[model samples]
Target chain A: MKLLAITSCPNGIAHTYMAAESLRKAAEALGVEIKVETQGSIGVENEFTPEEIEQADGIIIAADKAVDKSRFTGKKLIVTGVQDGIHKAPELIKRFESGDVDAYQGDGKSINEVKQERKQKQNPFYRHLMNGVSYMIPFVAVGGLLIALSLAIGGHPTDSGLQIPKDSVWKQIMDVGSAGFTFMVPILAGFIAMSIADRPGLAPGMIGGYIAANGSFYGSEAGAGFLGGILAGFVAGYIAKWIKTWKVPSVIQPIMPILVIPLLASILVASLFIFIVGAPIASLMDWLTAFLNGMQGASSIILALILGAMISFDMGGPVNKVAFLFGASMIGQGNVHIMGAIAAAIAVPPLGMGLATLLNKRKYEKAEQEAGKAALAMGLVGITEGAIPFAAKDPLRVIPSIMAGSMVASTIAMLGNVGNNVPHGGPIVAVLGAISHPLMYFIGIIAGVIVTALVVNLFKKNVA
Target chain B: MKLTELMDKSLVDIDLNGSSKNEVLDEMIEKLDQSGALKSKRKFRKTIEKREKEGSTGIGFKVAIPHGKSKAVTSPKVAFGLSRTGVDWNSVDGEPARLVFMIAVPEESAGNEHLKILQMLSIKLMDEQFRTELLQVQTVDEAYELLDQIG
Candidate 1:
């Protein structure tokens, strides 16, 4: 029998040659002709001929270092350590004689590598989102807390809704808080893009994000909020990365990283937002607005479910804006029940997410755990945008969970005939005496929060 | 020009005083340094220790070959030692090693032929009769004479 063996060690000095010697001695004693390739300090000595490899019955790779087994794909292979080659040479040979070893497939595109690749690629989307989320939490906290505080301490209800008087210090605090909310989406996009494509992606992502958050850029009344920011971040990041790979002239290569790639990507993504995606979204909002107006005459239960889903779906996106507008318009017509249902639904997303973090700490990372704490406070004041970070990271799981909870809350509020004369929603509105049947409104919010927390925890996997 | 050129009477120890693997390494390194085969004793020792950390060079059948390739080496050389009582070397066979060969080669070696000769010495040590005859050597001169015939 003719066999082949390759021996290598990290040092490639002594054990490599020693192992080769031992394997050769064993082969001689076994009455078999074997070729031993020694990869040592002197480099590859006694390498196999292609003909010899083809003629071999089986091959043994005794190496402590990576031996590219790609060349021996269809051959029976035994891979072990250099130590095993020196000491267990006879046993390794015996395994071959006993017909124990299997043929190797070392091409990198095999099942194992594919599995490894999937594991590597899947987590990064969330990882990049987490970078954005971490940066965004402070803004949301400052905005939500400041707004809730100002509305609580310095505001009174009116026909127009909860408003702090124009010249008051509380109004300035509220404006400062509004400024924080304004920057939240753009910062989230910027950081997410930065994580994906490094520094070059930040400008394009933030600009794309700014355009997305402002509806007037697309001739719509309400802007796309957190969800649009996420889309813009991904689009801008990938465009920057793609531009980075271009085979540009050596003269332009110096300018490419700093000036060209960022400028080109930013313009491309912003143009895409204003010219393409925005038009369809604006029309969808108009249609949704008309559909909700039509749904006002339908069963209150169906209207309740639809409003709940729209509010929780994008949190503050155009669909949510349409629902909020529909409810606000209803209040002027003395049909305050729809607004009450919408209000109950609005608070569910954030409160549910807050409760979810408390219910299972293992499912969220350190940053998210802290965000969850902040989310509870936002939820109390009825800021549905508080749940945006969690949903953006794992939308497939979180969005559905929050939607189900909001539907239940809105439906409960509708059945209890809860009426909110205010345009705003949440426990704060009910507490401020703007909502009829305050006890029932609280029950609806509580129920929705419970549903959101339990369902989201059930769907989400433990933080890796 | 030959394997015998890398060896001398000073590089042989028929009866090693060292009872442990590290002590024996130091004892042999001292012999190599004294023989003027190393430019720096500390650097060569570092290379040898780094190699040992990869996996102990104490292979089976009571044999160990500690080796290094470093800029610290002046010329290629092997220091041979025989322990009357085996030193515990953490061998693959779990047997205490009685035979030790420490080889030192220059990092940018100009002689590939000399390296081939060292490889021959490595292979020659695996022979059962050669190992038995090695242990039976009575003096450093006798050990040198036997090793001189290897390559």
Candidate 2:
């Protein structure tokens, strides 16, 4: 009996190999005749031959990204993400032995081909928005940390908020951080459009995002914020795509992308935002800002609940993005309180998961216990996605536990008047100076993290 | 550790015609069947397929080990086959396989026998002298003698 397998990951990095190694070890232990091909960042390794395929019993495709499957036609194929390959190798082998795998038909498409097909089918607007978000995350992290560090070391409490001396190096650091922050929206929009319509969409997307982030373009103080960036990315991508697809003279085609497409798309996207999407989004943003600003007592609790829910709902999905955008918009409006609440909410998931692993090792596998340590560290650094794996595996219990903890922390932050100048969440950001009432912020985060840990522990079964 | 104890002489093949992954597997399994090392063709295939589904047995270096624990396996044995033309076995290094080692172990003794075979194979395989000598051997008897000496 013969079998073929492929292993891959998004970054084509550590996880890919780790999974491959685990699978290999398991297969050897099971005493099975199998061939594995690795699609690493470097390239494809150990390709299969036609003769090997003819005698093979099944195929296993474990990848985060798409892998090509055109070669595995008529072979029993099991398709799953990489993590499943890592954790369920033994079980998958058992299933194959049971003769349950259905033969896979090659569509002559690899995973890349599948991804391209899906991308082509996706709504242009969403594609661009995702593109921007992917690019913007790193900028936000770098800028948010720099400012946070500056505030922690150099900030002095003042009437306006936490203030740093202008001559101080810390203040310079803050300025640099602020510069990176300034580019966040435009970069996000630019990349989104670039992903959608290629180079032609870049200028238009950036322009649209800039207009959205800065209300001055549309006659408003509070720009459409990250929401505007989303609008800009989509509008730019579709507009650029539309122009690219237009019928034109063959002679004019060469100049169309360079001269006509970009120029026309930029004008169209810029005007659309200026006349249509901008004003309404700005007003909507203004109302949200006002609502957030006015939440002083019991209303603050409601805001905390909503923010917490949004942050934990998808563990960095669309809901999390919405909540994050709201906090960032508040930062642009110079209302640090919302961002402070956001920071508290952000730390809860990772901290909670880490604590759960630490407190109850029996409930999690060895890998998960190891991941918990990393997740905790990431939480301190304000990366909410650290909890994504945990959430993805067990959403029902994990989500609610994280949400409750985040809400409690957010409420405490709001009530204590914790203010954050940057648009990031986590205890690390608070400790770094981006947050006002840093001590209380820390206290709130710790408390929330504890609650989450305890709640998750209560609900989580001892699977290991 | 004796090569005769691990390897069934009849299961060893001197020539391989199939160049592709599936064909190679089929040819190897057919050889095993002809030697009476495998009791049921379908069962043997299913076991091997199950193992492959778990993970590939291709370690880097022109060597491929495809093994499985199944009821069809009569004994814990290794079958050595040489393909000078380099049949693709989906090796870790993406290199075509010139040396194929198919292992079959009883389901009950799967873990220990599997490890023992792998440990023996890995140790001998790491020796460049042994690999060169093995590759130079044209006949199954020559290959078997070298494997026996190494074991």
Candidate 3:
């Protein structure tokens, strides 16, 4: 009895394969003939055939994300989430074999339709939040890399620490990098609200985020930063969603979205920031800046240790972003050493994971080996988030290994006077001349990477 | 396509104690041979083994439908037997099969006739009422009557 299955997940990484493996094993154990297809971040694998479908007993779809099911029409089908596929595969197969499943009627709405419907039903606030995150990531990568590049090329040793020559081309490159940094908050808030309320939310979310990022409007020196942008996005999104849901006359419905929703939501969101959330957040940002600026000796090392842990912990998550912003602010203050340590710490996880995969191919799967290659390239450019997929899957082993390595690297950078003129890490930045004691900087990074690789390899059990 | 056309009272075995796959297959073949349904045991066994070599026919859920189309058959027929202890059929789910349905169709009508019988069985198998009754039947006539009702 031929059977077909599809497995997928939100992240399209570990859970996808895990569910696929479970279904395959369960089918084999149940004495059922079956073929499984997996849809992952890398795309489709082991696809099904029309002939197989025609001869099949039934089809099983286990996915969190969308999967096309129109092909299974006229065949007995069991539709469920990926977790069900993993845990209840045998039972699902039994139900199929027992002929209990209904014939699949192709509704023209495949798995993609189901996913779109689910997305539409999600809280508009969350939709906006993800939108902001998605748009913000590329900007962060570009800004961080350019600054790292300018520092490596134009930076010189100075009493103020590593300093870029005022009139140099590299200095202009640094300015361009900071220019990208400037849009980080506004773009984040704009896209988030756009995701929620469509075109209308864009204006309000961006304006609110801009106001939140600039301290002058809120009567505080330090801006609320990305945190404020997130707040603005949620505020704008919900206000827009509420307005969209409200009953209006047919004549005014179209106008409501075009004018009323945007106007009302934007005003509400912007006002809330100016009157309520903005002052406290600005003060907090200022206090954080002051605390970091005043730190010295052991106190500074303690701060560095905390920063290193946070940066390595989630591999570009909120904690990592906070640490990153701290280092970035230091770059603006013309104190490059703290940023230098941050840069080194940032590259440790991805570089370490990549090194670990290369050092022991047998320890990782085929897909993981491929990811390691990508991670290595991203690590060289100081994109710590490249390691997020690995860390998300096996955080128990990957996170601690990365944290230890980053902490050690940060400490070494502090001790050896490896200062960064730019707010980035990785050997490429150092090679470009962004760092002081470039040799020691390389040593620190290499040492951290080696330690992380070794530690992760030691802890990770062979999956196969 | 009628269930009675595929199921025979003489082909149904009431006593099956085999615990191994080979033993169960042999017992089923012996009953089919005794009923004069299969002409060559050796050829029919070879056909089933060959089909298994290509891929397991055990479609999961503790059910093994080992089928073959060969000249060994006197007519298209299906034999039913229950092995409570279960027999390893190298099934897709890797579970030992408890219910065995062996179909032996003539080679000439193998394609259409075998598929029709399979479709009929597949549809009825989904009915809990049919399966529960079939499982509880202690006599060959009772099984054949249930098959007859499916038509």
Candidate 4:
């Protein structure tokens, strides 16, 4: 009759709280005594006391990432995904009532070993992708800001482009920034493979990504970039996984993951990138760049629309990453216009949501109004992930509203011939002198924010 | 203040005879009326009904906490009732309410005292052991003793 539950997600934000709320409601309806502990972005809340745990009939751990189960030893425990806690709380409780769960055994294994046991229940693709993205974001943010800072303080604008003086401290700063960018692809690929096949996939994935990014390995002038890095990651991950399944001698089993798997996966992923995937992708990249360069006023507007839609679609998802990588690669090729439009689009979601709350306070709850202030601060810093809380709560209204706002901004920036010299976006970058025609860029952002606020407010009903 | 100070023995109904949520609300308010906590039964009932319209006060766990701040109340008071059969209050969890706590506060003292009492009651209600003990109480004094543990 008594139960204890814990809910957590990778981001430890929306999903964690949602699952906990769902479980509590379900337990109430079921006429059961339950205590729910939530491990979220803010940290632990409503934690279970030792007496409560001792008196509890069972425990449920619904989390995407690892949760320590050693404390629950000898207790009836069900380990599952966070979604199951949200949507299938009653069923899980029934399973517990039916005595279907295994008693927790305090096996002295690492957290990864516990994680591997639960991995089979989740979709590997989504789990791997999210794992990769979480690791990749810090690199992009740090590199982008450092480069913008270097250009702002040390570079002199010329007919060719912004130029940093040789033999200066600023040039050294720029080099460090570039070094961060150089490792970005490899780290992304490395983590993705690690998510798929554990630590064994790390070496092969990094090596394959390096080969994909360097032009000398393949017969192409411009290296394949992040797109190739993604392909290399998948290839390395699967190859490592396949090698892991092989029935090697008992004596070699311990060393297989460290040596055999990595050695074979590296060879396989490298060969595929060099001989097959690299040249085609490079040519495709060249053709796409050429096409973008040839676009006139109307065609360029359409391209901007596509980029804007992609950027806002999932906020910081793979679609957004694709658009970001495209703009970043163009920066290396001395093309800044594409990045300029994207830069304007990047702040639209968080800025628009914030503005919407301010425009019509009646339409949002007290918590949402607080989130609005945080969103505005994040938007100023060019962190699109700020809008994620709003989107996660009400995707239908927020997604379309943000995408519309971003599209309008992108169109205005493209039309005005706005150009961003750096890989980053937002007004902060522009204020740092990373952008040209900063006045027009500001106008575009303001226009987009107003449109989004008005439209979203019109659609949303007054909150209780 | 502790719950024992505000709650009257006359206002504690150990076995409530009500099949519906409206009937239950009326039964609990009549107790508070007998205790001289409520000035006008009809006016206070209307106040409670209006508050319920905003949202159900059913805090789940087979408990309904209906409260209102009005001129009908001379002072802040709490009335406890137990409906063993349970009455539907349209709770968030879709469960019928069995234990009911009807709170009445004078409009002059409503701002701070009303919220303070609700916060104090809800926090204690979150403890399953306290609820279990309260549910098993067979006498008015026994029920008062359990609620007295809450500040």
Deviating ranges (above 4 Å) for candidate 2 = A1-130, A289-300, A303-405, A412-443, A447-464, B1-151
DockQ by candidate, in order:
0.13, 0.01, 0.01, 0.01
The C-alpha lDDT values of all candidates are: 0.86, 0.72, 0.72, 0.75
**Model 4: TM-score, first chain:** 0.54
Q: Which window of ten consecutive residues has the lowest lDDT sum in model 2 chain A?
A: A113-122
Per-candidate TM vs. native? 0.59, 0.43, 0.44, 0.44
Question: DockQ: which candidate is best?
Answer: 1
Model 4 chain A weakest lDDT span, ten residues long: A113-122
lDDT of 2 by residue, A46-138 (tens): 766655766778889999788877666667899997766656777777779999888776776664544444543445544445456656655
Residue pairs of candidate 1 with colliding backbone atoms: none
Candidate 3 lDDT for residue B136: 78
lDDT of 3 by residue, A1-464 (tens): 67889988653433456567667777888888888888865457787756677788888999878887766767788889775775687888888877889988788665444444454344444445555766765565566557656755676644344468887999899889778767767888888788877777888888887877776777765466566676787678768867776645444654776688888988898789788976775666556555655664446678777777867975543456567777877777777778888878988887898999999988776767766776776688676755654663465678899999999888778777778876666776676667888777777888999999999999986743
Quality class of the docking in candidate 2, CAPRI style:
incorrect
User: TM-score: which candidate is best?
Assistant: 1
Q: Which segments of model 4 are wrong by more than 4 Å?
A: A1-121, A221-227, A250-254, A297-300, A303-406, A414-438, A446-464, B1-151
How would the candidate models be sorted by TM-score, starting from the highest?
1, 3, 4, 2
Best by lDDT: 1
lDDT, candidate 2, B1-151, per-residue tens? 4656766678777677778767888888887777767789789988888766665655446767677767787755677888878876665567788778777765433113334434456546645577778778889888878877744
* Candidate 1 structure quality by residue, lDDT tens digits, A1-464: 88999999876766788789899989989988889999976678897766676788999999999897766767899999988888788999988899999988767555444444445345778778878888988888788778777877887887677888998999999999889889889999988888888888999889889998998998888777888899899999999988876655444755776788789989998898899988989899989988988887789999999999999999899989899989999999999999999999999999999999999999887878887887887787778888888887788999999999999999999999999999988888888889999888889999999999999999987754
lDDT of 4 by residue, B2-77 (tens): 7777776888888999899988888888888888888899999999999788667674677777877788887668
Query: Candidate 1 docking: what grade?
Result: incorrect
